[model samples]
Target: MTRTNASLIGFSAVALWSLLALFTVASAPVPPLQLSALTFAIGGVLGLVWLWVRGDLKALRAVPLKAYVFGTLGLFGYHFLYFTALRLAPPAEAGLICYMWPLLIVVFSGLLPGETLRKGHILGAMLAFLGAGLIVAGGLSGVSGAITGYAIAFVAALTWAGYSLGSRRMKAVPTAAVAVYCLATAILSGVAHLATEITVWPGSSLGWLAILGLGLGPVGLAFYTWDIGVKGGDIQLLGTASYAAPLLSTLVLVVAGLASASLSLALAAALITGGAVLAARAGRQA
Candidate 1:
């Protein structure tokens, strides 16, 4: 795809992902592990169908086992913890905290060969961290369990950051890799569900809609489009643009009555977006 189209796809992925917290929260009665397993299972099946349609199903075996291992761990680890945070805390707050991944990506990208860390990146990260701090502090005042949620959300962010960074180094086809990752995540989550939580499928139409939407949109198509965008488009611009997700996510949660938008949310958005813009500028100059 052309860079413009790729960029649009990338932005679309971010927009879709912004709804993930809302959907995951809506699917609450299902429990985190089971919900993850079901959603990813659906996504994995869709991905396989996509591969078969493209005549790329044969390519899965050619991918190194190491890629599958890391990809599975990364994708699974993030979503599992992310689901936990959404359950334990307000969706808006948890969503913002989890978005630390983009900032982490900007910083970690410098660790690659011949990549230089710039002042703007450092500055931006600090600002973003401060914004995250404000969010956490604000969240803590509202709920007793917010601390644990924030901590898990941060870990989720770190997992995703590592995933994105590691993804850039792999030569495997992105969609195929994501398919394997989703399948592996589903298996592990299923095992975890059996060991811990009761398996309860969504019974309500609203709950089922949320699960299907998450599986098809954010979990399935978004990953493929994101891989295409990051691999083919302006990485800096996409990275910067993704800062909008938290703001948009918070707005969605508020409008849906899942959470209230507060002053902390606005300030956090500004700081994080500012930092992301700065980091993007540094990348462009580099």
Candidate 2:
């Protein structure tokens, strides 16, 4: 596929991820590690089915052990932290903080070979960080309660950004390898859950459906598409486009009545979006 096509496929992941917070919240009372295990298992099965249909199941065998380890850690670490953050903190505020991955992606991409870190990039990052500060400041009244979640969300953002950039470096790794990564993540999560978390299945059909939606969309196909995109597409463009996810996600939460709309969220969205645009422009000029 052309770079444009690859980038478009990558952007589709962003659209799917917009529903992440909503589905995660809806799948409530299911502890983070347990939820990760269930959703990732479903996602892994989806990937395996696709590979079988495409006759690409054999491609996984040639993948390096390091790639498997890296991918597993990346997927498992990010989702575990994200789910825990949302469980502990308000979904909207926590989601916004986690959305820092987009800005982090743009900034971190500068460290890649052949990429230049322009002044505009730095300025944009500062602006985006200020937006995140707004999110944290808005929750200051309850900081004593939510501080750990916010910190974890910040680290989750860092984890995902690192994963995306690391994927770019491993361009030769087949996208199908992510299937193995998903399964491995599921196993790791399951072990952790069994050791620490009590089993809490979905209490209702709606809750179960929410888990299915997450498995099929954000956690499942999103990773596959993202792997293809970062390896072959315009990484900087994808990073800039990713800022839209927070806005779309927050809107979804509001529409579903899972989160109330707030002025701080609106302002944070604007700053994040505008900062990404500015950073993208700088990248183009370079």
Candidate 3:
């Protein structure tokens, strides 16, 4: 794919995940654990099936156990914990909290070989973190749950950072192979989610449909594209495309009659986006 295409695909994945939130909230009565699990299971099964059809299931044998473990922690652990947080907290809160991954990635990237602290990266990190805080703090009109959910989401963001950092080490790995394993990790999380649920299948057709979207789009395709994007970090357009996710998510909300052109949210977005952009630039220049 061309750089533009790859960037588009990358950001689309982010939007797909964002769009799923509306479906999730519409069906919010379902347990987060179960929903998370179902999404992963479907995504993993599809990935594994594709791997098998392509005769690449054997590739799993060649993967280093350590790297696979890290992938699981990033892909699976992060998803499960984040979903759990959603159940404990509001989606809006969790969403903003989780974007901290970008900032965290900058911090983690600092530890990489030849990765000297850049002023842009430092500044960007501070900006993003501060903006994330404002978005969360400013929009706390009807927050639910204790600080624990927030805490879990925070840890989930760090785990995503860990995943991002570890993903940098897995360069040259086949994109499909990496995606399959990550989906496999997600399936494990889903099984754990189902463990406590009262039923095995989705309660309604809508629920099942959401599961399908969760698997095919967000859990499966999105991650695959993200993995591809991470591998092609040399592409500047990928950064530009990354902005599309929030915008896409916002679009999803608008389409669903969920979010609107609110001065407050716009302001919050400005703070978070501006802050994150500035901090990222500063960190890079550092």
Q: lDDT of all the models against the reference?
A: 0.78, 0.85, 0.64
Which TM-score value belongs to model 3?
0.78
List, residue by residue over 195-282, the lDDT tens digit for candidate 2.
9899999999989999999999998999999999888876876876776666677778889887678998889888877777777688
Q: Name the candidate, 1 or 3, with the larger lDDT value.
A: 1
Error of 1 at 225 (Å): 2.5
State which candidate has the highest lDDT: 2
lDDT for 142 (candidate 3): 73
Clashes of each: 0, 0, 33
Q: How do the residues 26-123 of candidate 3 rate in per-residue lDDT, one tens digit apiece?
A: 55566766666666667677777878899888777777777666777778788777878876777678867876776666656767765555565556
**TM-score computed on alpha carbons, candidate 2:** 0.87
Task: Sort all candidates by lDDT, best to worst.
Answer: 2, 1, 3
lDDT by residue for model 1 (1-286), tens: 6877876887888888789779977876888888788889888999999989999998888888888899899888898888788888787678778878877776777776556778887787777666655655565655455898889999999998887767766635455878988889999999988998887887799999999988997877788777777666655556556666656766788899977879989898898788777876886787
Clashing pairs in 2: none
Highest-TM-score candidate: 2
lDDT of 2 at 59: 95
Candidate 1 Cα RMSD after full superposition onto the native fold (Å):
3.4
User: For candidate 2, what is the lDDT?
Assistant: 0.85
